[model samples]
Target: MKFSYKAIDDVGTVVAGTLEAENREAVYLALAERGLLPTEVASGESFLRGYLQRLELALERIRPVDLIFFTKQFRTLFKAGIAVVEALRILEFQTQNGKLKRVVAQMGEEISAGGSLGDAFASHPSVFSPLYISMIRAGEASGSLAGVLERLVYIMDHEHRIKARINSAMQYPKIVVGALVAAFLFLLSFVVPAFASIFAGANLTLPLPTRMAMALHAILLQWWMVSLPLILLLLAGVYWYQQTPAGRLRRDRLFLALPIMGPVFCKAAMSRFASIFAILQMSGIGVLDSMRIISDSIGNSAISHEFDKIGDKLREGRGISDPLRSAKYFTPMVINMVAVGEESGRLEEMLQDISDHYDDEVEYEVGRMTELLGPLLIVALAAVVGFFALAIFMPMWDMVQTVG
Candidate 1:
């Protein structure tokens, strides 16, 4: 349940914000924890308004760059001794994204209402991730919100650059594959049909490749009405399945097992895990809590599940490195470095090293994938063009010989 509450803070300024709680008592307790005196608490939102908010959130997408800029500017402002609410108000005005601006304004209002910074961020889960909220909560508790935002800006910027590099490497292959499909479709739809009609007029035996090409052309021309819907249904089913838990697990596993791209993804996930874990630890978050938070931050479900197991073992009083040895995705080097970090009392430094190591590895693997895939794509393209050429010209050569 959500409640809108009016409160008076230490200086007796009135503040108001919405909070999720089981009852008014919970709301009162939460406000008290924040050192606020609650005057009034009202429960629930109108169904239509709630529906509109949900729709708005679904439509509003916040990009990484937006978050990076927000955090960087926020850290600079807060470090300059501006009050949190004042800094947020500045951001609310300075933000370029209309949706982000609204979110910033709402956050400022929440803070003005005597809500904690973490709570304000939590209210917008689409804009703030679990890792972000947890770190902010830790920062609030430690009185290091500005520092935390600095680290967040760094992490978000690094992640964006990594993704950018990977996407740049993939752009060529994507364009090549798309072109191949377009050319093949055009050949089947127009060129092949014309040649197929000519072969039909000749009434001569066609080679197997020619026959296969002509059959594909026939399907494109005659069966498209039936085929289009089935193709769409198959794609939709695939998307739905991938969204399911078991299907996501299998799909992520398959991603890690892929030949050229697997190591890039694996290294990227490891880099993210180490980076987030290090920052969370540095921010005064406990090891177990960091593990739980990092698990959700990792993009791969298979790796995330392993982190869950590691968290379970941490609950059993085992150290982080020991259980990591048993995880399939944790490289031997990572396990050894973690073990050393545990013994040396330099876990944060070690985690940073691990993150840096994997960051380099991800870069190298992406470059290697580009190199390997370039030749492979060329070979595949050659084979496709050669096959189509043979399929079309073989019949022409045969006709020429017959006429001679």
Candidate 2:
């Protein structure tokens, strides 16, 4: 546990700080050992604990892999007949990440102090998500926490795979763009200037393209003086805009509505929703609650808003397929499958199929798009370079012919 402490030293100097320790008594003893008299020692169970809890909660938002590993390890240990508190204690020592280690230690202490596994995880809500907590609660209620942990691992692994594919798909384009930008800067700053110097002394009347190239080169040289502030202002504007809910919504909508990427984005979002819903269903969470949790997990405001309406419809006892069909973001085929699932009482199975199907579709589309982008970008670069070369040399060719 962590505590905030204020202590007076032997020479009457006061010191205040926070530290992680075993308990309040241990904290006081440690201070006394340092020749300090504790004037005020705030326990980890106080307001400071609440603050740490909030920080832990935020960290949890980004640590899906960590959660998966923890769950998987805990389950493995549990199945081997290791006690829960003992397993957590071993995990605390085994973890290399300081924050995770600290968290595991805290959990171990909590459980050892008679807190239930779910309650221990609940205390660090930042690390364990609603889906995680819900599934654990179900497992506890059903007396199958080990099984639930295994399922959680599978779900997390699936999510990781999807994220990896997206990253892989984007990597080529990112590299291409980065290379293009570097090459452009090199030419404008060095190559173009060298050519410009040579042409300057040639006393030739340059052609239109050559003149345009020279103008561009000059502007680039001068641009930083104007461009720097403009860029900073643009960044500031973007930051300010994103800070506003409306602005963020508008930005998200724009991203989803992009011509080439909209379909891919929508498919990815749908895939996530389907996969999360399937996991929730399998974990014994109800349909409406599952939808709400899945919506929160999707991470897009526009899609989440539509999901909210779907939840409302579900609350009114309408079929899941009805609101999903009305949303129009999902394809007709998807809606049909969902309808079939609803009718067959196998929504989880159908959702898993949907997730698998779209994941493949997304992967294929991303690969195709990446393959198409490479040649298109290369052609554009060649055209720009060719135009500049022809423009500049044409004047030189005319000059050489006259001299000959």
Candidate 3:
């Protein structure tokens, strides 16, 4: 077979070329003999064509549930003493997701060709994060791949739960906002104009609020040509700002400073940091390295920036708790727990405890927000709608009273 290969030469320059080989193993050995580290090898034009075809097939077959099921199934199979290669082959055949099947097949082939499981996964960094890869590498070194996979499944499950909670919390607010927007547009575009015609025909002097509403209706009806474009442009500007790193950082910082929601955001960040740090430490990664990885995965640039400072302090031989306490983003309780963990040499356990504690705090805060927001939003919406209704209707009511 002909293979396309990527390798780094002795002098560290990356080279890509095609070579004839029996399989990927042959290509890897051929490169290794020449003091090149083979990064990847795929068989010929046929492989590339087939891979693309299979990718589409896989996307149609895979769902979030399917991915979750596969993770669980793989964990089960591995625990049942199945060989990693065989387990992957079984998963490949069983997976409905075309992409997942192809990935499983590639992983199986790579493992069979003497590549480490982590190395096989490293080929798909988008699907598998550096944290995942690091854990797997640590597991392999400690001869505990199965244990690592189990922990990974647990971590992913927890992450998914958090996502579900956030989605659920946002759903009602989004619906309410959308409904209010539609109602406002309907009033301005149709209802208010009907009232305006009545007042005009009756030749009555409208109240100040009623006159203002009629004027707004007229502007909306007549100048939408200008207004619509302006609205779109403003939206575009906001989107562009959010897409930039500085803008995102500014927005996240703003979110963390919000009155009711700011504490929730901070708690969420702290929970994530605690959880990921705990997992990395449990996986046998060093403190400094784990902190770096955890910081990268925290997802908020502001929080991540703070973590960079923490990592720097650790590198300079400062205690973890001291740096974190100095940062002032973390709560005193969290700092104290970390200090205890560091002193007792059980930082991982302490981090896990902190994560568990904060996870509850986040959930409670979200629930409180939901309870408070529902009534607040309803009252606010009612007030706005009532104001518009009174503004338009009071004039017509007075005109009727005068005629009667």
**Which candidate has the highest lDDT of all?**
1
lDDT of 1: 0.88
lDDT of 1 by residue, 1-404 (tens): 98887899999999998999997899999999999999977776664466587788768778888898999999999999999999999998899877899899999899899899999999999889899899889889899888898888878887888899889999999988887788788777888887887888887889998988888888887899999999999999999999999989999999999989998999998889888888988899999988888888887899999999999989999988989988888899888988898899988899899999998999899989999998888887777777788899999999999999
- C-alpha lDDT score of every prediction, in listed order: 0.88, 0.81, 0.83
What TM-score would candidate 3 get against the native?
Answer: 0.81
Once fitted onto the true fold, the runs of candidate 1 whose alpha carbons sit more than 4 angstroms away are: 1-60
Candidate 1: 10-residue stretch with minimal lDDT: 42-51
User: Which 10-residue window of candidate 2 scores lowest in summed lDDT?
Assistant: 57-66
Task: Provide the lDDT at 15 for model 1.
Answer: 98
Clashing pairs in 3: 57-98, 58-97, 58-98, 58-99, 61-96, 61-97, 62-97
CA lDDT, candidate 2, residue 72: 79
Pairs that collide in candidate 1 are: 16-113
Q: List per-candidate RMSD values in Å.
A: 11.9, 7.5, 10.5
Error of 3 at 304 (Å): 1.4
TM values, all candidates:
0.85, 0.80, 0.81
Best by TM-score: 1
Q: In candidate 3, what are the lDDT values of residues 1-404, reduced to their tens digit?
A: 89988899989899998889888888888898989998878887876887788776755644556666778888899999998899999999998776777788998999999998889988977666677778888888898878888888877777767667766877777787777778877877788887777888887877887887788888987899999999999999999999998988898898888887788889888888888888877777888888778776787778887888889999998988999987847899999999999999988899999989988988998888788777877887786688688977788688879889
Name the candidate, 1 or 3, with the larger TM-score value: 1
lDDT at position 251, candidate 1: 98
For residue 173, what is the lDDT in candidate 3? Answer: 76
